[model samples]
Target: MGNIQKITPNFWFDNQAEEAAQFYTSIFDDSEIVKVSRYLNEGQEIHGQSEGAVMTVDFKLNGQKFVALNGGPQFKFNEAISFIVHCATQEEVDYYWDKLSEGGDESAQQCGWLKDKFGVSWQIIPDILPELLSSSDRDKSEKVMKEMLQMKKIDINLLKEVDQA
Candidate 1:
């Protein structure tokens, strides 16, 4: 037939695929759970998940397709990969940062990055972040980068203010 219709990012969880997908779809707009499939005896020999247990959850977050797999805990989520929540305003950034950081590792928060309770890293960033950090004026961009390094959630106003300084 045709080429691959979509590229779905798969998330591996330790029996928390359903929970993580629900939480993610709830946070983002225009998102929803498409379907869920439970484990069967087909390949339980390796997975070890009991029958009827969650196997996969297909979902959409902010209109992006994703799949959550209830894989065992042989692997862990680390900072190597992170989802970026781009916002147009400070309020949007704050809202996402608050929700994503809830029940998360507070110590892991830095430079607009935080790990959610499920250990998934997220970057709550302003839409103009790139422009601010790549401004024609080196001083402005450098200062913005420096200021950003000291904060947990991104501070759009602070970045703008520092840009002028």
Candidate 2:
């Protein structure tokens, strides 16, 4: 058998499991759609999905496994849960922020957080963000925090400037 992940995040979509999976795979490297399962006649009454409709999509994004389910509109994504994308450089943060925020809700963006078209929340942050925000120097940390709060996309250079100021 292939390797199995102990825990996997399942994304609920309103009939867009396949589409969401494809979109995510396209944005990240080393990503691919692993399997697609179709709804069957047996569960048609409860699921309300056509027998041939895509029911679930198993995919991997940069080696992390995930499941996208066409589970209808009973639930929606919120900021309470978010995927954090740690980046080593501003270029990486910019790349991920732009790609993930395309077609997403602009009003939902703040402090490096964005909601994708699928309503999934993502945080595109620099690897040094945690360090800067939790520094021993209260003034430097507070300055960095203020700058970060003002940004929709994280600016590594601006955060670093807090140290010199």
Candidate 3:
């Protein structure tokens, strides 16, 4: 049996927590919605409006916990921090790249870095990155790095080819 655990990430949305959660869960495997609680009647009122509404939501993405809060339009997702998906083949890279890039912008970088439509950054990298970095040939490693810097989704075969050259 699976052990009891907690996986949580706090996400601020402009009244789109549910929508975003559903969208995210749809894109990933081994993910599902855990619970959603809307506002209820609390004896207190602020500005003639209910003080609490959708205080919190718990969802899971690939066994990771994420908490979505209906915090007003105070902050938004940026590229400062991003989720990295390590892939072993071009097929894996293509799958994630196509899925996440939907309704999002794409920026190419060395290794891997791309900004999705929601302004959230993602790095779709290959499993061979470490191998290339630790190669004995500094020139080949440098070349691989230079080539990677120009790509959004890392291509493992391409990196290997660069390393060989």
Error of 1 at 131 (Å): 1.3
Better of 1 and 2 by lDDT: 2
Candidate 2 wrongly placed segments (more than 4 Å): none
Looking at candidate 1, the ten consecutive residues that score lowest on lDDT are 1-10
Where model 1 places Cα greater than 4 Å from the true spot, the runs are 1-5
lDDT per residue as tens, model 2, 1-165: 987799999999999999999999999999999999999999788999888889999999999999999999999999999999989999999999999999999999999999999999999989999999999999999999988899999889988987669
lDDT of 1: 0.92
Task: Give the Å shift of residue 144 in candidate 2.
Answer: 0.7
Give stretches of model 3 more than 4 Å off: 1-7, 41-55, 107-111
Clashing pairs in 2: none
Candidate maximizing lDDT = 2
Question: Which model, 1 or 3, shows the larger TM-score?
Answer: 1
Per-residue alpha-carbon lDDT of model 1 for 101-156, expressed as tens digits? 99999999999999999999999989999999999999889999999999988898
Candidates 1 and 2 compared by TM-score, better number: 2
Per-candidate clash tally = 0, 0, 6
For model 3, state the Cα shift of residue 135 in Å.
1.3
Ranking by lDDT: 2, 1, 3
| lDDT by candidate, in order shown | 0.92, 0.94, 0.76
